[model samples]
Target: MPELERDNEVELAYGVRLRSSGVSATVGDVRQAPTATRPVRGVVADELLGDSGDAVARLLPVVEAAGMRTVLAVPLDDVQVPPTPFGGVRALTGEENYVELSVPGPDPDEGQVVLEVDEVGLVRWHIDVEAAATAVAIADNGTALAARGVAPVRAGIEQTFRIPIVQLDQGGVGGQQRGFLGFGVRKVLHLIRFPIEAAAAAVGKAVVGWWEDRRRPHALSLVTPESLGDVPPPDGVSAARLAELADKPFLVLVHGTFSTIRSGFAGLNRSGGGQPDLAELVARYEGRVLGFDHQTLHVDPTTNADWFLRRLPTDRPVTLDLLTHSRGGLVGRRIADPALAAAAGVPTPDVRRLIHVGTPNGGTVLASPKRWTTLIDVFTNLFSMLPEEVATPTAEAVIELVKQVATGVFNGLAGLTAMDPGNPAVTAANAQVFGGGASGAAGAVRAITSDFTPAAEDLRLRALNAIVDPFFGTGNDLVVPTQGVFEAGDYRVTDPFVVQSPSAVVHTAFFSDVRVRAKLGEWLPGAV
Candidate 1:
């Protein structure tokens, strides 16, 4: 162990070297601890053991079983890396100084180093570990920087890796204003390595099990008086209830990926100052509103639609209007697909009107296989700032997905791939649903889209947008592309309600807006 001084590289214990220039901070000796101890700090600890801890706890065992023997803890002072030569900062910051580590062995397992910078940026690791499939730099807040297609650079016999340890301005977002003070606590960097294949298998198993336990793929519950707004239904829709609801044109609510009906439409629960709300919408359908809750991470939308169709009563004909958000819109479209309905051996419900809020009909690049890590990064940062809009469990699901992706286990995530522009499923769906134009058999297709640019007063959101806007070159709602919601292949959406820039309305907050509520009321007219 040695003390690190400015402009001089010091060799610490375990064949690791530390160096710093332009930045001033006290670097502590690197110590090793067992991975079971969970030696983590700042936002990483908060994400792992937060309110959604139980949901994400399954990931730890996967990491431990991947031959991770011990964790390395590196301590440093509060440091901030200024904005890059470019306008905005990326997920990884401060590439100038490097923390080099040498593993003296013939062969070593795959390893990872988790670094945090004042709860903002993450340091990148350039690994030359032999036979390692990939090297990823993960931010404390669950942002992963991985070389997707590129193979890891293999050096000589002695495996040596250099990690860029940097800092972020504590005065910026998630700073003192947000009550994140890192004064006395030691900022420890946890380092662990494991076999890639074994880790991938373990991650896949754990995540699949977790998804199976949490998601109800074919569950459909009605919105009754007892389960009005953001309240979970006591039970699934019974055969009698379905027959009764099928007598009239009912409304169906479809939620997006990593979300439940209660969480996705929670925004509709807010009072709209004499405007229409969720209660009014439910009453319009005479309490016949059905909510489709399905698995979103593992299965494709067609599968979800098939499961949903199977739950419908075959004895009666049903007519329904659809209200969908995000990926749920894809499922709704599939349900509205007459060919698909026929294939599923069920009569297609007469879809009178379909309202898609923040739906990615044209697909979002963020869901591309290469950009999956960036998608997680965007969601993690957005959820950190807007915690109230997203439920903790939903956020935890995102966290778990990111963790699996970071560990090179992103092969089986078909649901996310369905949102990719190049995905055949998306192309086929677009061709079938919107191919016949807006007046197609699916009925009147409407959308509520937003190009969210944070207002001047929303400093935190603005700061986040500054870092995130670069990922999506065009206008977006911080998740899906703005124009993609309404503009598909040959079909051009007509007269969609668009939320312009420089507003507080984000993708998740659309239903909370009075103007959106007004638009919904105007379109549906609620039992008038």
Candidate 2:
């Protein structure tokens, strides 16, 4: 890396380019072969190229290989590097790269993939929920940060970063391929940009996400505790709907904690316009839909299960088809639990199928004391990223929110205790749902405990998010490390999606995901 000049020309030891624009011969000729001791240098200026002295060394060899006598820096070549606050770039597959939230953390362990916050280190206290919050911040603010010069990497759970493999022109540094970055003879800068449309899309999505969460809860509490007994059918349903339910098997969609009906099915709004192909799961089971909502934060699984028992017919010959997401899976589990039902004074419903979109059947790392510190630190950083005027207030708000989470539910709410892995209800559910042997509950618990934790994650996590961190702990969905819905021995009656993957399915998304929807179609009796 060299010092950047105001005119934008980057001065190398050998010569200077008009800019690092990656154009050929735009600057004075300087014949420096990359193989030579001296290297080539150049730069260009535009929206995302260079500003305030962003430079890189060892670029000469690559440029020389591209065969250009004059300097023409491609804007994309230097993205994801220097002067860029947002992106964190690393080799995903060999020389290829992958861009992520780009935050700091301890390097991963031998076989794990941990995304530890540099400050938080690891969860060590009730306040560590902030670390979990920070992970959320990275996800929430990721796109915004990318807007300011982050490179466009390939997309997928386990995708490639497409690094440039230079092929020197036959004519060498002054040849036909000069200035080209190897795309069938073109000198184009294919990189990400912060376009007006993108910003608009972000705004639109935020609004959509808001309305989705806020709008669905008041359907006369069709799924809420307030509407448990003899509640009128939800807004759009007709009186005939009850009769329809009696004749046909019904689909019950259970939402996770802090989620709404739309979140289980609809897509977040686009930053520019319109929406993604959200609600695919919802669409398939259209005729048989029954969305369930509940007070998850303060309420226990037994309470939610009781509501489910009250809402559905006790003696329906047909079992209800169930689709549960995140903690909703716990509710579904309770519905399936005869003992729990008996204890709660509720009748159990027969289940047709259970598809989970990242349920913490084994609880979450965010709840681990050793890991919460990291969670809190990351969230605090997110608040710090705000403007000073808002930062203080934002921090205060976060503290208050955490306070509620801590106190409102578990009498100090376990300090956001419901999510705690150590929660009695959560552990009990895992024991029952996964079975109690090594091949069952014990194994899954061990994986979630040793493999999913920040310490184990360092050794087990992977870029594909495939090796557990979201792939194969026991297999994980990033959030849920088991990579599956349930264990083989859990039950022969029906299968359950215990651990989730792709990060999306770990919590809020289920119906909106096509693969998930397709799986539902295959697994459910009448789903299309």
Candidate 3:
């Protein structure tokens, strides 16, 4: 390698080329230098640049003054896994640590010539490919410490650099010489998610739940409110509130996930004006619209259902019509269960109708580790379950392994865990209400589900669908698949309205669909 000699100090420089797939390009200018370099040695704590900044910032003054240009960027836009038959292949890149530092040597006018680089940034990648690297990671000499968060997963990549072998007295360009020198290596950061620790915990819990399901599955039948533990006492509707129902029925509007009274049922207040939200509009259909806001993240659906039932007005001025969105659908079905309603002190027949919009009755692809594993298990089991041998492996058995492997990848967050359709607790409750083909209490309560989504029409949605469509299916309202709102036997009992429109009705926008309110009014018989 050709080196630069100025004031007796030698600075090494080299040229590099990047190749991936079938395309190739030189590295882009470092938009931002990474903070840490791999193969860390004797360096003090304060010098590390991990928390908020890049390590390149510290080296820019020295490297720039040395007259060298540096650049970095992901070739081909993104390093993504190729799609496969089991839906979209979901292989994640571990860490890309190999950083190619390209430096142009000093001009002939500078008069001094000589050189060899002692270090190159780290080369990090999946364990499978880590061994096949050509770079070395090393620390800078005394005092000049590397920044933070920039340690490549795999280090010590070896490579050769091409430098021009020049004549000391020459003014014009001359022949080239190739030399292999190791440059300081920095780690690559994927700043899109939570810390590694939190992610691991989520996966651990998800796996435990997945395994637990086989040991004890959900009842999938009517359960009493008393059975739903830790459910907060139901909020009671005042006499004035019940009196308002005299004009119509009790239109209970329940919100799912992260929403509150004002933001959810009450409808958010926009700048100048806004249309009535689900609660307000649905109220017009039969009677007074009441909001059911529960702590979604920590509490599961059953617990929330317990709280939901208790909050109701003891004696209604009118009949009851239950309407729910997203996760709210889970609670709605539980409420419609004859056993649960009776336990809550209301006659099962008193709660007459169930209307669900964008409910994840089947399961949610997002945060439902069991669902993702189910994606793999479904296809694997399809072929695995062909044989009917008594001692042979079964699909149910395979689900445990698949779920463990899959859910273990992402710890089950409390909210996601509670609503996970695959979880025994959630599945048991659902099966009791939705699985066996009827919408609670046989023909006692009439039920209907309306699903609306624009699909992958927009560019952003298209990109997102590319990643999730494999699990959630192609038709989704961004969060849950519109079809997931309905179970396998749902059509046998509940009337389904799957809107096919070129116009997109996004997740939050489902409440704004004029058709939903109108349909509720038509389907809902006037007061009892």
Q: Which candidate is the best by lDDT?
A: 1
Q: Residue 436: error of model 3 in Å?
A: 12
Question: What TM-score against the true fold does each predicted structure earn?
Answer: 0.73, 0.42, 0.48
Better of 2 and 3 by TM-score: 3
After TM-score superposition, the amount by which residue 151's alpha carbon in candidate 3 deviates from its true location, in angstroms, is 25
TM-score, cand. 1 vs. native? 0.73
Q: How many pairs collide in each candidate, listed in order? A: 5, 67, 50
lDDT of 3 by residue, 1-528 (tens): 222121122222123233222111222222222322211121122222222122233322322322222222221122122233543223211122122223222121111111111112211111112211211111111111122121222222322222211111111213422211111111222111001122323453343343333332222111112221111134335545554554555666666654333333321222112344333343355435555655444446766776555545556423567767777777777776666666877545345567777777776655353233323322222222122221012222332323222112233234555555545565555545342345764233333343333243232233233334554545766566666666533333345776554654555545445555455556555454
- Model 1 Cα shift for residue 258 (angstroms): 1.2
lDDT of 3 at 199: 31
Badly placed stretches (over 4 Å) of model 1 are 1-206, 213-216, 224-235, 385-390, 433-440, 456-459
Ranking by TM-score: 1, 3, 2
Worst 10 residues of 1 by lDDT: 42-51
Model 3 lDDT, residue 432, Cα: 57
Identify the superior model by lDDT, candidate 2 or candidate 3: 3
Q: Mind giving the per-residue lDDT tens digits that candidate 2 earns over 1-528? A: 333222244433332222322122122222222322212122221322122121111111221232222212222232322221432222211133212111111111100011111111111112212333432443344323223221112122221111221221222323343321221122222111111112323443221122222432323122322222222344534334544555655667676654444433332211112222223333444545666765454456566777556544444433566667766776776676666555655444456555555666556664443333333433333334333332332233233233222211112122234455545645554445433332221111111111222221221122112211321325444444453334322322233433233233333333435545545555555542
